[model samples]
Target: MTDVAPARPGPAPRVVLVPGFWLGAWAWDDVAPHLAAAGLDPVALTLPGLEPDHPDRGSVTLEDQVCAIEDALTGGADGVATVLVAHSGAAAAATVALDRHVDEVAHVVWVDTAPASDGFVMNPDVEGPEYPLAVQWDEEMAQGSMRGLTDEQLAAFRQRAVPQPAASLRDRVALTSPRRLDVPSTIVCTAFPAAEYRSYAEQGVPFLAGLLEYRALELVDLPTGHWPMWSEPERLAAVIADRVPRGAR
Candidate 1:
């Protein structure tokens, strides 16, 4: 009998879900079950300062958040890469972490957000130790739409919201690796269409600038609100499941 060749290793069948400011892993509850059903393990993360109850505020820096993400990206079984899913404000820290661990990530799915350019500060208005969610929500709405969220969903969001560390927002991004752009990336445009994001990228928007350099980047239009995990979770889950590396699936 001819000897059989061993199967090549694939990425870990895991997806790390990181939510934006003022939210925790609980924000992904609606979408996690569906991902699990699709044969992907979902590890939802609550960054250092956003944990339930008042954790240390004002003290958690952007580096702290980056470390948290790096921790999640490591220790996969069989030394396989992982898929990272970052939503809203979490994308800033995720971008820096991705830059450092580009080889460890199979793909990055930025939900209604984009990788931040180096030196980008997440929130310029944070003056106190803890930045409240209300103020940030208003500013976010002014910048984009929260179109599909219902009153009940909005109330629940408010109830579950926590104060984000001022330092995390104030700290600037420090990306040194140009190789991170080689990793595959997908931007799921929710509040706005892919066309709009492309337009911004063409016009040289600071936040969208990194998208231009990504060697493998895709933009998917999901058509909901910025917080699609809450408003269109099933569809969002489906979109993410489709991007899981085929071997992992």
Candidate 2:
């Protein structure tokens, strides 16, 4: 009888989605299913204080957010690597998780934001049990991505928007593991082209300075307002699905 070879294992197919300020896992509702259809398992998360009914947002710090992401990344099925998708201000929390669990993370997709540098606070001046929506809709509509949304959709968004915790925004980033920089990353740029973003980095903008630490970085431009997930979810999902590690796909 001929000897038989053992079957090879399939790719690690997992992704964790993290949302930005004043939003929850629901923010990814339109995108997650598409990722799932592409053969990747997507886990969308709501951070500690971003919940609409959370009572003690003042005590929720950046560390709390970091811990939540770390747990989600590592707590997946054994031997399966995970990719992290963090939007806006949540990129800081995702970066900390990448730093803490470098080996377990296959890649990171930052939506419209990059990781902040050490000592950088997300929103320092917002003193809040919860920070309220402060943007002027008319100005935002003129220059923002919500131009495609209907009046009813805009009203629904405003109703569902929750207050972000002050502590999470105020805390400075603390990255200990430099190896996190070695992990591959993609920045999905919305509201700006890749060239403009690169220019900002080259011009030494303080916020863009952290991009220097990334050893393997790719910029994917998806021009829309800052919140592409809301305005162009199908396109956003397609872009993200393309970046999922080939093995996982």
lDDT of 2: 0.79
Tell me the spans in candidate 1 whose CA falls farther than 4 Å from its real position: 1-12, 135-144
Q: How accurate locally, in lDDT, is each candidate?
A: 0.85, 0.79
Q: Pick the candidate with the highest lDDT.
A: 1
Worst 10 residues of 2 by lDDT: 1-10
Q: TM-score each candidate.
A: 0.90, 0.90
Name the lDDT value of residue 96 in candidate 1: 95
RMSD of each: 5.4, 5.5
Worst 10 residues of 1 by lDDT: 1-10
For model 2, residues 71-168, the per-residue Cα lDDT tens digits are: 89888877776888999889878888888899988888889888666667777787756676654577656476565565775776788888788788
> Candidate 1: how many backbone clashes?
0
Task: Give the alpha carbon lDDT tens digit for every residue of 1-249 in model 1.
Answer: 112233245543778999998999999999999887776779999999998776578778889999999999885775554789999889899999999988889999999889888888876877989888763367467345666888788888888899889998888899999999889899999888999898998898877877777889999998887899988898888888777776555
| Residue pair clashes in candidate 1 | none
Q: Record all residue pairs in model 2 with backbone atoms less than 3 Å apart, i.e. clashing.
A: none
